[model samples]
Target: MAQDWQQLNEQVTALLKTAREQVLAKMQSPLTVDEKTNRKDLVTNVDKSNEQFLIEQIHQIDPAARVLGEEGFGDTLQDLDGRVWIVDPIDGTMNFVKQRDNFAMMIGIYQDGVGQLGYIYDVMQDVLYHGGPALGGVFAGERRLKAPANIALADGLIGASGPLVVHDISHMQAIVHASAGMRVYGSAGIELINIMLGKTLGYISYLKPWDIAAGKVLLEALGCQVTTIDGQPLNMLSSNLVLVATEKAQRDILQIEEDDVSL
Candidate 1:
């Protein structure tokens, strides 16, 4: 029998809300922090605990589904075969630890490598950006989001990873100069939300699958483009220079990069 995804969406939404609340309550106490790869890449006890809690709930809801999580608490998935859930329990661990805000919980549901549903929850603001192709449209809270205008890159703000801009990778400096301006919010989920809200024309970053998975589903549902910086399809299991933008913005940005290369 096929799964009732709408029913599952409702169930998982409630589960994520409960898990977020529990994590928030613990935030009032002290945090146990550790460095992942470097001092800039930090993780706290909350990150691990939240991933564990989410994975446990996912197991209860769909034991057959595979879960890929940031904290390494979920399954070791090599491919997106059957039912799979890609999750980031605390997306901006740095922001969560240092600023206590601007973080999110994200989940993307895929079956046979096809996206079915996506969710990005702004845990501090209690805003959820969710839905997917199967849902017919994406939503902010209960309000259905309209597809953003196809604004060109030069006319709208762009959300970018600060490091990418500072290091000038892939002519990122040139890209920033061509945009109306740039905003760095530190959380990929929040940055993607900015694009969904039409607050930013686009966002670019070197993102892992878990980082962009949920946002990719919702972005595509809203008629936005999610692809590599060179305008290639994103690999669901590998990191890439991901760009989520309106159609026109994507074309404009890629053209700008191309022009820079020619010069």
Candidate 2:
């Protein structure tokens, strides 16, 4: 049976609203925070509860679809061989626990490994960025987003992962110097939102599957490029130093990386 993407999108949108309400209500109280890997890497009660809610709702929407949720509440799959949904219940957990402003909830639906639909909800701002190839194009709320200008690396602000810049990995400092400036918003979804809105030329970060999945769908649908640092295609299952940028900026950054190795 063919999936009605439009109908599925509608259902997912409503589910996100309910998730948002739950998150906002939880913000009134203290969060139950725990360290995941380190003090820097944290998770909260909200993250787990939200993932459970989302995965349960998704199962109700399509019993055949499998979900890869960040909180380990969903199905375990060896491959994206069927209808699959990748979800991040709370992206930027540190920001959510500390500031509660810059975090987001994201979901990406794929079929046999092909991106079908994406939703990025900026929970605090009440903005939802959603859509994909099947739905025609990407949108923020109701406004259709146009392709961002093809700005080069030297001419535009570049978004960087703070740690990458601090460590000077991948010649990140040189990349920043070649750009007009740098911005690190601490959230891949939020940084991708900046890219989709044309507020920044590009962003470079090491991201997990859940972190980059939804933004990859939304940004690519808006005519932006998402790839590895060397301009390689992503496998969609492993963590990598991902680059999301306008075409021109992508070319410029890759060139810089190439030149750095020659020196």
Candidate 3:
């Protein structure tokens, strides 16, 4: 069967909205939480239920599509051979659990490794940032978003992982000193949203495919650069030290030495 991405995008958007409603209803109840890889890496029953719900809906909409979900509810995908849906049901699980305000839900649809549609839903804010190459423009809620200016690192704030700064990984400290300011947002989706809205010039972190897939699609569609610290292409199937930034900020940040050298 031939795929109509336009129609599929609309259907997926509606599905995501409905999923948001379902998740919000569940949030009013007490949550059952569990540890994943470490104490800081957490998952709740909401995460599992949401992933299951999303995978089920994806199967209904496109049964042949391969779904890769953060909660392990989907397939063990080896490659992006066909239609693939990468999902993070509850990004910022810790925020969802502790704060409940900074979390988001994200999905990225790809065809043969090419991004087709992307969505990042700020569950509490009711703001959905979505679109892709197929859609031609990204949007926040109903308003179409403009591409962020190609600003320099010294002129804009940078979002980073707190530990990255504490540990001084890849000269992150020097990069921070070069930026106008810094923010530590626990959620990757929210950090990406900040960059998309021009609130920050860039965001950097060690992120898995599900954590970055949707953001990569939306950011790149808006002419932002999404790549590794060393300017390498991101592998959608692997975890990476991802950097999402404006072109100028990316160039400036990449120029810094990887060692503990001052800026």
TM-score of each: 0.97, 0.97, 0.97
Tens digits of per-residue lDDT, candidate 2, 131-155, equal 9976889999999999899889888
lDDT of 1 by residue, 32-130 (tens): 999999999988999999999999999999999999999899998888999999999999889999899999999999989999899999999999899
RMSD of 1: 1.5
lDDT of 3 by residue, 1-263 (tens): 22487788789889989999999899899999899999999999999999999999999999899999998999998899989999999999999999978999999999899987899999999999999988889999889999999999999999999999999889898999999999998999999999999999999999999999999999999999999888899999989999999999998888885444664
Global local distance difference test of model 1: 0.91
Candidate 1 error regions (>4 Å): 1-3, 261-263
Which should have the higher lDDT, number 1 or number 3?
A: 3
Off-target runs (Cα >4 Å) in candidate 2 are: 1-3, 261-263
Residue-pair clashes per prediction, in order, are 0, 0, 0
The candidate 1 region of ten consecutive residues with least summed lDDT is 254-263
